[model samples]
Target: MKRVVAVFRQQKFEDVKRALLAIGCEGMTISEVKGRGRQLGVKESYRGSNYCIDLIPKTRLELIVNEDDLEDVIDTIIESARTGEIGDGKIFVSDVEEVIRIRTGERGSKAV
Candidate 1:
């Protein structure tokens, strides 16, 4: 099993979620997050003053998928989350040792 953590622009959350669902992804966890990447956010104006907004709002989507569907899931996220510009987001893939469904006690891929 593998865990995919995809962080994208807040505006792209809905599109990314829809793409994941379309790819037969059963479930995912989404969270509103604030952080900065390479650009370290941008400058903004509030009223008559200009300020540096260091932390930008983003959406984090986490999904555990079987190895067979890993590529498809990543591709779907990348395609849906892209804006053809910087700060579009990032996707991190890592090993998942275990997964257990709390209600049914299901484990491994079935739990996903």
Candidate 2:
């Protein structure tokens, strides 16, 4: 099993979600997050003043999938999230030792 964590521009959330669902990835956790990468947030103007928002708002999507589904899921996220611009965001994958469904007492891939 694997855990796929994707952080992307807030505006891209709907596209990503729809694409993932189309590809049969139905279970995921979504969060509203604030973070910055190499570009370090962005600059904006209000009235006559300019300011830097060091922490930019982003949407985070996390999913657990079987090993076989990893590549497809990653590809789907990338294709849907890419904007050819900075802050389009990033994806992180990690091994998942186990998954358990408390209500059904299911474990491993079955739990997923």
Candidate 3:
């Protein structure tokens, strides 16, 4: 099993969700997050004030699936999230030793 974590600009959430669902992904967890990457956020001015916003707003999605689905999932995220600009965010994949569904007490692949 594997856990896929994708962090992207908040505006891309809908498109990303649609892409994942179209590929038969059953469920995922979404979160509103603040982070900074290579672009390092941005600067904005109000009135005579100047400030640096180093923690940018972003969306985070987490899904656990069978290892075989990893590549397809990753590809789907990239295709949906790319914007030809910075702040597009990133994806991280890690092995999941086990999963247990709360309602049915299902474990392993069944849980996923």
For all candidates in order, the CA lDDT equals: 0.93, 0.95, 0.94
Best candidate, TM-score-wise? 2
In candidate 3, list every pair of residues with a backbone clash. none
Candidate 3 runs further than 4 Å off: none
Which digits, one per residue and each the tens of the lDDT, describe model 3 over residues 1-112? 9999999999999999999999999699999999999988799998989999999999999999898899999999999999989889999999999899899999999888
Expressed as tens digits, the lDDT of each residue in 2-52 for candidate 2 is 999999999999999999999999999999999999869688999999999
- Give the top-scoring candidate (lDDT): 2
Alpha carbon lDDT at 34, candidate 3 = 97
Candidate 2 segments whose C-alpha is farther than 4 A from its true place: none
Tell me model 3's lDDT, rounded to 2 decimals.
0.94
Tens digit per residue, CA lDDT, model 1, 6-58: 99999999899888889899699989999989969799899989999999999
Q: What is the lDDT of residue 105 in candidate 1?
A: 100
Models, CA RMSD each: 0.9, 0.7, 0.9
Weakest ten-residue segment in model 3 by summed lDDT: 39-48
Please give me the total number of clashing residue pairs in predicted model 2.
0
Q: How far is candidate 1 from the true structure (C-alpha RMSD, Å)?
A: 0.9
Ranking by TM-score: 2, 1, 3
User: Estimated TM-score per prediction?
Assistant: 0.96, 0.97, 0.95
* Model 2 CA lDDT for position 79: 98
